[model samples]
Target chain A: MLQVHQVSHSYGGSGWRKSKAAAGKVLDNVSFDLEPGCCLGLLGTSGAGKSTLGKIVLGLQKPASGQVTFEGFELYTKGRQGIRKVRRDLQAVFQDCYSAVNPLMTADHIIGEPLRNYERLSPAELKRRTGELLEQVGLAAEDGSKRPSQFSGGQLQRVNIARAIALKPKLIVLDEPISSLDMVHQTLILDLLSELKDSIGLSYLFITHDIQAVMTICDRVAVMDKGQIVYHTDSPSSLPSAEHEAVQRLVSAVLPQHPSLRTSWV
Target chain B: MTSTHTLEVRGLQVRVNDGGKSLPLLKAIDLTIEKGQVLGLVGESGSGKSITCSAILQLLNRRGLEVEGSVRLNGRQLTKLPNREIRMIRGREIGTIMQNPMNAFTPVYTVGSQFVETLRTHSKLSKMQARAQAAASLAEVGLSEPARVMKSYPHQLSGGMLQRVMIAISMCLQPALVIADEPTTALDSVNQLQVLRQLDKLRTEYGTSILLVSHDLGVIARMADTVAVMKAGEIVEHADVHDLFDRPQHDYTRMLLQARLRGRKDA
Candidate 1:
């Protein structure tokens, strides 16, 4: 379970010192609640401060105001001990799969890096578990020896997901995970996320600009505009009725699946 | 325009010779685009869609790659044209809008300077004339403050803004053909819609032919008159957009359509 209460943030400021010279707030009094074992979709366009919010929730960046409570523990104010306790229970999968992993590291070593830090495992056991994680994400165990350059965009993302679910983390912050992939790969990745959620009881903070992606995997959807949650819906199917300019733009932008259904003059 | 057809490709083939082995990049392909029509090319990555564009543009490295085919633009043979003449034809006769707008522009120069330079290169317009033309072109693309956008550098603008700038440039000359390679893929939803609308406006207003290449079927269905599905360096299916989407002839195309994330669209 996670709760973000009136969290606000702006760039160009460091530490507890708030700079008056800082630009306008990127996130303005944002609040959300994610129930246990349920995915929360944060839908927004570029520069909507979606990633910044993700960083705040991950405790990688400190918010300017308000509180983020994850698993009944405060992320920022409770300091090092609170963060250290929850670090292993939270994981992330980013958009650019190739840049997320080190080029010099092999797949097995990349996935095993977290396990090594969190668990005390021998070399043989670590290798076995790494292989098992790869299999769980629909990748071959033999792929573990290859570098990031060897895999395609979709395959590399699978490796990234493999690493995220390796610890069986309670929540995974997926920031535009399928945006960089093609349609086929997008379907596969969405299906894998859904499967992982049902199998291991995982929760997700799914950040994306895609409405269809949210409809496929998320239980609830929140539409963010200019760093504010302008619309909130219990389900994605009801998104079309929202009157917000941002939501309407997103809805109309989704091109029809078949040419016969196309109404636009293009 | 001198020629009725804007672009025509006949038996176009491309191959790369690595050491002693020759790998085919594009098989013999045939395509044609009339004035004010859109031809959609769709395929997976490494399926020769981009290669086809590069071959048509003569942008591919000529050292090891062999392009064996005829490419005609408005009755002019592009494949046989000298570098000097083809260079003249590139931006003047045939425009291009690539996926990444960042790469299309220089970081140091102001957008106004670049637009003026591109305009002056193809025409005998004076500096002042080109500047006025640039502002009008930017305004045509729906940029609210053309003067501010022109003064700002490429880095200062968002991807959508830069893409609109690119569209303004490509359409300003009223080129016969425009090759748009994933033009809206990098943009957000609203920006993508705006860019697509601008492209459509060009076809309707200026009667420009467009070779729209993308992996997104929805985009193709909305924009293209005819669709071509390519797989493994060859076009497997070429048909009307409606027929291709409703009744696909190829298995690969069918699989791609099926792979699209399907859910309830109505409220």
Candidate 2:
């Protein structure tokens, strides 16, 4: 459903001060493909350009080079209206849920905003759809009346998810959606994502530094290092050769076992 | 050296007043850390890990917060000390690295200026001396060019580099104890490892005791000598790192470990 070829992006431009001159490239010749109904997990450190890639795919940022196509249609060539329509088909769950939704708006308004924009629905239908969306995401109907601040981080994230899927987008870019959450809440969010994907037959572009999270949610995984895809594997069992020094270090860093591993050390 | 127990906590409790009623944030708790040892405090949000640390540092506001029990650092009672004495000990005797490095630093000033200011506040060092020490500390924390970094603003550096700068600033004081509250939570995996490795090195070289607070079990396993599992403002289990991992008696600890392991296996 998605294809990106030889994309590159840098932060600064010419005529800047000497110290800021030629700011290093954030993404270098990045390429990837995502099939329909499959999750493509992007794993990278903070500066590894994971978010940058997500932004490019979402058409939020213009890539310095390379082209992005969605089902053979040029994403950038279509301009604003086409891009907006495409965006309605491609949703995103951002990292910070608290800021993702407007604080002044109630959950009903927040979740209903996308539906209102993308589809023409009467007031009664809008309210009904908002309630249903909230319920779908495991939230109560009463929650739609409350503001963003009244909920916890996990709950806010659920609201964000509800809004993202309100339009029933074909693809969802989950950008470190569970990073700020605690263990139990993290699991809950992951489970919710899985359930939503299955029920809606939606594809996911999961971006996170969390190797474990990627392993759990992704059908395929790609490890990005220094703005390049260092390894790509079809499944957890098919992880790139551990003999590769970088991959070996990453594997070791993940800490595969628990209590027994701890006890054995003692 | 002093006794093995560099810091001791006994029945520590914290309560915050909300709507004219006291809402207990931390239940009675006990903990101890030996010199050069790393202790991990693990919990979900609102579990009171951060509250406990804030209580120890006397950073909690008295207007809405109440603290009970005893906290001793190097045989001195932290709770009993007056604010002046506590202020004297804060940055000089006990350093802290908070979760967000960007929030911790000032955007208006260069990193060097902030570092010198921090040094001058606790010591009688001149600007040049403080600058030199700050550069040295930055270099020690793995900054490629400390001199250049010193002149750069906080926004000029990446999140990982900013975090490293925070670590440098905290350790430059040469405190006996360091309280790192999710120090690498905002960092990516590589930067996270870099920060943790640097912290490990700090403990080794300076014999500085560390209290590492995080929700990630993998992080706790790699860095902690002792592990304390916290839930809803209380310590559910406390033991040596190996024991806590190998034979977690508490169900919550086991669950956390299981979740962490399941995550690893899935990866």
Candidate 3:
């Protein structure tokens, strides 16, 4: 489980300020929780500070105020030890697969790097596990032998997901993981993520500006606006009931229903 | 609206030289945009949505790509027109809004100057008259300081600002049909909403027809009256927006509509 408590961050001075410490705040007193095996969709428009929260949660950046804890370790407080613990428990899947991983590296090497660095494994075992991870993410076993460029955008995203889960972290922070993907692939990726969360017991802090996305994949949804959590719902079905103008706008913008819904969902 | 039909394409085809071999990129695509209507062209990458737009705008032929078939704008034959005559109509008759507004602009020229130049090309308007109209249009799109926007270079503005200006410029000429190729793709959700709303306003108030191409179904749903689903260089389905969403005839359309990566809720 992960907890973000009273975190706030900012940059840029009002005028001729001596330091960024005196700069304007971008994130203001934001807080949320990621329950075990739960996918929490963090929804917000651009510049709403959702990404800032992600960085803080990942221990990549220290917020000017508040703290993020993974399991029992205070990610920002445990210092190097806390950071290392978070690394062992937390992983991330980025939006753009083309830039997320090294293009020249074969999918095998890309997924194997985390295994090689985190655990002591023989080349044979590493190679075997890479193939398994690729397959687990719904890619062909042999596909791991090809470089990132040799794969389509959706396929490369699968590679990225494979790399994220190679270490079997407790939680994965997916930052618009399928934004660049086409519709069909987006459905496949979402289905894969849901299956993974159920089978592997992985928690997802899914961040995106999309409303329909949260309604489909997330157990709970948090809507942010202007650096604050404007609305939070336990069931995504309740999102339309939210009174915030931002949430209303997002809900209203959800696309018309599709024929696929006849067999699947509302 | 006497003319319900604004733009029509019949059996439009395109082929590109792939390593010295001519490969078909678009397979006789056909669609129409009615006056005051928005036609949504939905497809995954390499589905020939962009190629369709290029075929209409004549960007394909200029790049040495081969095109065939017919595109008509209010009975004007766009495909067979001479290059000079087609050039005159491409912008003045069928305006285009590209995905990236920043790259669409001239880096050195002020946006105001560009607007004036574009307006002058389409109509017999003096510099002062064009400037006034451009500023007014900018303000109409909720952009403040129209004068400053005109004076500022494209780089000086944000994506949202540049997009608003782009919309302003495209609408200023009051072109019959606007071909917007992923116009809101580069923008944030808030900006995307603003742009879509402004476009919707144009169709209602000015009766401008728009060819809206995007991978975002939410956008297409909101802005489009009709929808065309393209896959692998072919149209899989075409229907009214309501019909397409309610009863998509093709598997590809259903897949795209459901491809938002959502999961079933436990509750």
Best by lDDT: 1
Q: Which regions of candidate 3 deviate over 4 angstroms?
A: A13-23, A77-79, A258-266, B1-5, B19-21, B61-64, B80-85, B106-114, B120-127, B144-158, B257-267
Per-residue lDDT of model 3, residues B1-267, tens digit only = 233468988899888888899998999988888889899999888889998988888777546677888888887777777888987887788888888899999999999999899999889999899999999999998897998999999987878788788778777888899999998877766677778777876777788999999987777767778899999999999998889887889988777755542433322
Question: What TM-score against the true fold does each predicted structure earn?
Answer: 0.95, 0.93, 0.87
User: Candidate 3 residues A14-120, lDDT tens each?
Assistant: 55554535436779998888889999999988778888888888889889989788898888764467888668678899887899998888899999988988999
Candidates arranged by DockQ, highest first: 1, 2, 3
The per-model lDDT (C-alpha) reads 0.90, 0.85, 0.83
> Please, what are the lDDT tens digits per residue for candidate 2 over residues B41-98?
9987878899988988988887777889988898888887788999999889899989
- Residue A61 error for model 3, in Å? 2.0
Winner by DockQ = 1
Tell me the tens digit of each residue's lDDT in model 1 across B168-258.
9877798999999999888877788889999999999999999999988878978999988999999999999989877898999988988
- State each model's TM-score restricted to chain B: 0.96, 0.95, 0.94
Worst 10-residue lDDT window, candidate 2 chain B = B258-267
Q: What is the TM-score of chain B in candidate 3?
A: 0.94
Q: Flag regions of model 1 displaced more than 4 Å.
A: A13-23, B1-3, B261-267
Question: Candidate 2: which stretches are off by over 4 Å?
Answer: A14-19, A240-249, A259-266, B1-4, B265-267
Taking all chains together, the TM-score of candidate 1 against the true structure is 0.95
Question: In model 2, what is the error at residue B78, expressed in angstroms?
Answer: 2.2
Docking class of 1: medium
